[model samples]
Target: MNWRKRFRTFWNRYASQVLRKILPRLESMAARLSSTDDTQELSEILATYKMSGFPLPMSFTDVDTVIENALSTGVHLTEAKNAEFALAVHIHPYPSNVLAVWVYVAVLSRKS
Candidate 1:
């Protein structure tokens, strides 16, 4: 595996143990500091939150296998005409871009 995957695997194995040992001490120290001072604590919290401005990119950049398995391995026509007929029959009955279409698919797919 590449360095990124290796790093992730290493982190998954040890990061939790490290955090578990350190988090309580950090919380106790924070509590002690805030109890002694209020305004300074609030400002520090706001500053930290601001400094931690969320990381960008919603998902991973490189994707190798987009799909692990198909919905079925059975017989079915795979063409634009087949899709056109299927959509015209089932989807037209439902509101476009709505949850009803998803619900219909989920329900219909499990019928067999």
Candidate 2:
């Protein structure tokens, strides 16, 4: 039995379903920011804005670097703290290349 193949198929299917659910929200957010004439300002806002209702992965890190890179006309992830959970965003410029930004939101857990 090809377990790897099966796992790949399952992962792809799950990822597609998640993307279908999330793409609309992302598009809406993009549209809202599209009115801005300044790309730098847009990038800054997107990097700093706190996202809500997104099921972020628990293996996220490197958020500050991402924000800095995004602000400096590039793509990267930033570490907001020293843990998992991050906000990832990509900036694509027409007639230019695409820049990605990732913001890692550290998980603050309280042990019982």
Candidate 3:
């Protein structure tokens, strides 16, 4: 299966809330920032990220892929490449569920 679809499936299983709203907001925001200046976009993502609950069924590497995919503006995953790893946060909701979430912000550049 394609990575995008895999990401959606991963979200369905692990994401704390539905991404239908926030994702587009992020995409629009990312789209607005110049690809060369993904630092701004990465900062926005790190500053705004607030996911809670759900354990990761995947790895940090998988998460890096998700961040890269979700924020990508290209027509396909192959059409974009991560230019930088700005930040990565691993959240473990304490006490009960022990949910592990890997949150990250990345800079993506259009493929040449």
Candidate 4:
């Protein structure tokens, strides 16, 4: 096969494997976050995001940062109830830039 064909084959195989491994993990994590109370769930989600390689922004330490990042990045978030949030982000590379797509759904936590 030519180099282009070889590259394509390699990329497809790699992407498929990576997605298969990561998707289930992501789903499980999201489910866990979605099922709990607002504070606990948000904490877990932030921790997961940090552990998953997206470091928290140094300038802000509130849930707003998470929401903003999710929106700015083009993640696709679903419906949210009171004091809850959920979103998915996809990152892609371009020739001269990186694109982050975020979709966000969120509900503010009840203040004490």
Q: How many residue pairs clash (N, CA or C atoms closer than 3 angstroms) in each of the candidate models, in the order given?
A: 0, 13, 0, 12
User: Candidate 2 lDDT, tens digit per residue, 1-112?
Assistant: 2312312211223223333444334444555753423334324334534322232222123555544433343111223332122233333333334332222222211122
Residue runs of model 4 more than 4 Å from their true location after superposition:
1-82, 108-112
- Cα lDDT of model 4 by residue, 1-112, tens digit: 1312212211223222333334334444454633423344335444433212222222233456655664554222222222222223333233555332323222223333
Best-fitting candidate, measured by TM-score? 3
Q: Work out the TM-score per prediction.
A: 0.20, 0.23, 0.24, 0.21
Q: Can you give the lDDT of residue 112 in candidate 2?
A: 23
User: What lDDT would candidate 4 get against the real structure?
Assistant: 0.33
Candidate 1 or 3, higher TM-score? 3
- Stretches of model 1 off by over 4 angstroms after superposition: 1-11, 33-112
Rank order by lDDT, top first?
3, 4, 2, 1
lDDT of 3 by residue, 11-111 (tens): 22122232222333433344464233343433443454432221122233345575564455333333222322222344434355553344433333323
Provide C-alpha RMSD values for all models, in order: 23.5, 13.6, 14.4, 18.4
Query: How big is the positional error of residue 97 in model 1, measured in Å on the Cα after superposition?
Result: 44
| lDDT of model number 2 | 0.32
TM-score for predicted model 1 compared with the true structure? 0.20
Write one digit per residue (lDDT tens) for candidate 1, span 1-112.
Answer: 2322312211221222322333333334434633332344324334422211110111122222211111121112222121110110011122453311110000011111
Q: lDDT of model 3 at residue 34?
A: 29
State, as a TM-score between 0 and 1, how close model 4 is to the true structure: 0.21
